[model samples]
Target: MPEKKQKKRPGGMDLDQKAYQGIRQMLFFNEILPGQKIKYQDLADKIGVSITPVIHALKRLEFKNVVSHAPNRGYFVNETSLKEITEIYDTRLLLEVSLVPEIIRHLDAESMDRLGKAFDAYREAVKEENYYNRLMTDMRFHLTIASMAQCQIQLKILQELFDTLLLKYTRNLILLGIMDSSLDEHVHIVKSLTDRDMDGLRQALSTHLDHVRNHITDGFRKMFAVKPRQMVDLFSLQ
Candidate 1:
């Protein structure tokens, strides 16, 4: 029906792309905070959709380890342990840095064209008022380059890291009012990749990851500093 077709997907997206956009936006903005209790029906209402689509979206998010279902408690955002986050970034630095050569070697005219378009979309997202769109566009641009390289295993690693680290960094960036910087980093990474500057790519990726790691680390410290100090007396007994 025309009415069904016209229905906006959760997160202000068209019905066809609604589910994808909804999850992508949610992850990108860290809208679903870590350890926050979530109910499917409630999330559905918040997004202005139904429980069916939300369930579908949550299933997809589970693959990325972004959300988990607990018996009796329903669904909730996954908490990222500091140690786990460190391990994720370590693997990311190793896997993605190794991807530079493969991507450069397989680089072709058409692939570069597609990369350019994705990068442009990221730029447009930055200019737009929609934070959700900016996040989705940013992911599209990076994933496009990764796909062009055609490395399945590496793609999996990047995908995992993207889900794990995105919220941590996204939340920090938002708190710092530097959401635009996230978009800028995507453009910088794409530029390095487009130029076939392996060294540039290496440096870009390193800086990008380092910035993310620092952001999360700093955020954790800021958020939990007082709570950790509260444990000092308990640790003193040991």
Candidate 2:
């Protein structure tokens, strides 16, 4: 019998994936802000794809809790409440603090060098005012430390938590002048790790997370304050 060749799949999947990533970046970079409604045609136009793929991409985002779809109102970005944000930060502190000891046990010269490089990249991003790159590199720096613990389950959970928290909040904080202090806090963390000062590392990590919680909560309160509605006369002429 002759060997049968496998049929090639249509390129629709590729387009769908591309659209998914495009919309995700839009969300991550705040091109589409939280609590804002979005139209499929608008997303299709922005992403340079047909409406079908945009719909599929949004469905995927909806599955990830990145967006919510309403029957008649279309899709809206998922909004994180102050209470939810506080709970997330609290959970993060517990997971990351527990991982610190494991990270210390697994640290080697190569790991330290990698951490240095990640830190350097983040600093460069900060200097260049590249908010998107800074956010990514900052995640990398922290994830690198988490990976040192060699616990896949813990790392995966932490990554998901970080993603959910960062999607809408961290960019606002960076814009509000929190990056400089965050970088300083990271420096203290790295120094503690380098010196194998376990107590110092715990304290530094706790302080850093506390600062993060404070900055984000404060920023949200100021940014999301309700404004008084302006009364408009229906028959007014300009």
Candidate 3:
């Protein structure tokens, strides 16, 4: 564990909310990895809270499918699932692509500025050492584009899918290797949007998403390619 100073509770938030944020930060930074057991007391100590709140926070994470609990064991960071990820990727592809038209419809100076900032953020994040920051900024790049569409329900669903992808599967992202191409892809997206080329924007979105989906699929294949007994032992730990 990194030496973290005691965290004060943020305004208007309960102990559980504070603990939740603290734990989630740790999760994002890979201070803990997928399938690793969570120590409630350790988390409570680190977050400067009581175990009660940490446990409560964990239950909420469970509802979000961010962690899993095994009988007689304890809470563990969520293990990635090929089935779940496929569903999320497919859904995200459809939602994001569909939103492109609305985004083009609403294109304006403010939206362009937001997209530029999002791209700039992703570029800087990629330059940094932290993989989590890169993932977050990348998510922001996509979400910024989608938000301009102004489709409330679809946007909410897209956010949920993004949350699942980030929190649940990110620990294993190393298996997918460096996604350095996404920066260039992002540039393509921004350019297309800026030019108001609907076809170009759709292609950019589809191509970028397909590339990521392919990487994830290959990574999962590598993970599951182990011998049958070994694969069972692997999941048994989670």
Candidate 4:
């Protein structure tokens, strides 16, 4: 008698999250370079899955405008354009600043202390030159505060912005690379929150957003100086 063949087990991810994870992983690791052509079947093969999952993933990316389909040209990875990044940062600043009052009302002494610990970890990650670790911890600190606001919709929006920025930030930029003072900014934000200083929170958030915008602009300029085509200004094209 022939031996019975074992059935292949399904992947651990649910369909939607699996698609999200696949796209996110590709974007984060720089596997899918900007301006690269995207073929659904090819992507399916590359990811070692089927065309169904790949198409689903591409649709999600398209909704995010991370991928675009040109007539008869299949799909293409959207470049991290100047206008898109600026808009993302601006929207994020507005959302975060508006949440300051709500956050102040919700945070207690213990939550503030927890945020402090997260900031400490971020500082250590920066000192050790663990770039990704520092980036994640900084996100953690912000999300902790965002959570205190008790707004689920805002939390979801914030996560999307954070993911988009993290994907784009992997590229080299002088302002960000040279001045890693994110921890300092976090300290100020936490202090304002602790003291229930709404004005201070507003100021701190504004300063932080300005710093981020400057860094992004400076980094892209530097990157473009090295390679002219690496930078994209989407609004200029429009």
Number of the top-ranking candidate, with lDDT as the measure: 3
Across 1-238, the per-residue lDDT of candidate 4 in tens digits comes to 9995522338556554565577678877777778889777776766666777777778778887778889888878887677777787788888988888888888787777877788788788878977667667877887888887888899899999887776655543212444557768877887788788989989998898789777877666665565445344521231
- Total clashes in model 1, counting residue pairs 3 or more apart in sequence or in different chains: 0
Would you list the rank order by lDDT, best first? 3, 2, 4, 1
Superposed Cα deviation of residue 18, candidate 3 (Å): 0.8
Model 3 lDDT tens row, 1-238: 9995554465767787899989888876668777789999899999999998899899999998989889999999877788888888888898899998899998899988998899998888878855667877888989899999989999899988887776777656644635768879888999899899999999999999999888887778888787869855754553
Q: For model 2, how does the per-residue alpha-carbon lDDT over 190-220 read when each residue is reduced to its tens digit?
A: 9999998888988998998888778777766
Q: Of 3 and 4, which scores higher on lDDT?
A: 3
Evaluate all candidate structures by whole-model CA lDDT and list the values in order: 0.69, 0.78, 0.84, 0.73
Instruction: Tell me how candidate 3 scores on lDDT.
Output: 0.84
- Pairs that collide, model 1: none
Can you write out model 1's per-residue Cα lDDT over 3-91, one digit (the tens) per residue? Answer: 55456634666543565456667766556677877676766766666777777777777776778888887778887566776677677
Alpha carbon deviation, residue 170, candidate 2 (Å) = 5.1
Cα error, candidate 1, residue 45 (Å): 8.5
Q: What lDDT score goes with residue 52 in model 4?
A: 71
RMSD of each: 8.3, 6.4, 6.7, 6.5
- The count of backbone overlaps in candidate 2 is 0
The number of clashing residue pairs in model 3 is 0
